[model samples]
Target: MPSMTVRNVPDEVHRAIRVRAAQHGRSVEAEMRHILESAVRPEGRIKLGSLLAEIGRKIRLTDEEIAIFKSVRDTTPARAACFE
Candidate 1:
């Protein structure tokens, strides 16, 4: 395990983080840990699955409708590329 010591943090910024940590029921150190984790882990940071699930919920697709849609996919030939 590694430890970091931040020095001379601006008073305003320090106060803000302390206040934010309190708002989220966290200690200042714990809040900073979470912030660092989110900064470093790009895949962990984003919630694409949750967004996709929300989109899916709005779509209201039934199994039969999905089968129908799948059956019709790629039926048309691709348009010939235009090169001028």
Candidate 2:
């Protein structure tokens, strides 16, 4: 295991961490670890075209309208394919 030290923390921030840790039945160290994990985790990008299409479908956009949007703002197919 790696040892780490974090300095220059404000008193209020420490109190907030302790409160949150108690709320979740975790020690301050464990809460900090969880926070770090979530903050540092990688995330995938959302496809604008597909997302727009889904939203369009939900809102009952016509096929023609959807096609127009797909044509005008379609991302480069190569970069889009990488997401899948």
Model 1: CA > 4 A from native: 44-84
- In terms of lDDT, model 1 sits at 0.88
Best by TM-score: 1
Error of 1 at 31 (Å): 0.4
Q: Show the colliding residue pairs in model 1.
A: none
lDDT tens per residue, model 2, 1-84: 886999999999999999999999999999999999889877775889799778877999887987797789857666445654
lDDT of 1 by residue, 3-50 (tens): 999999999999999999999999999999998987888674558878
Off by over 4 Å in 2: 44-84
Please report the TM-score between candidate 2 and the true structure.
0.50
TM-score of each: 0.50, 0.50
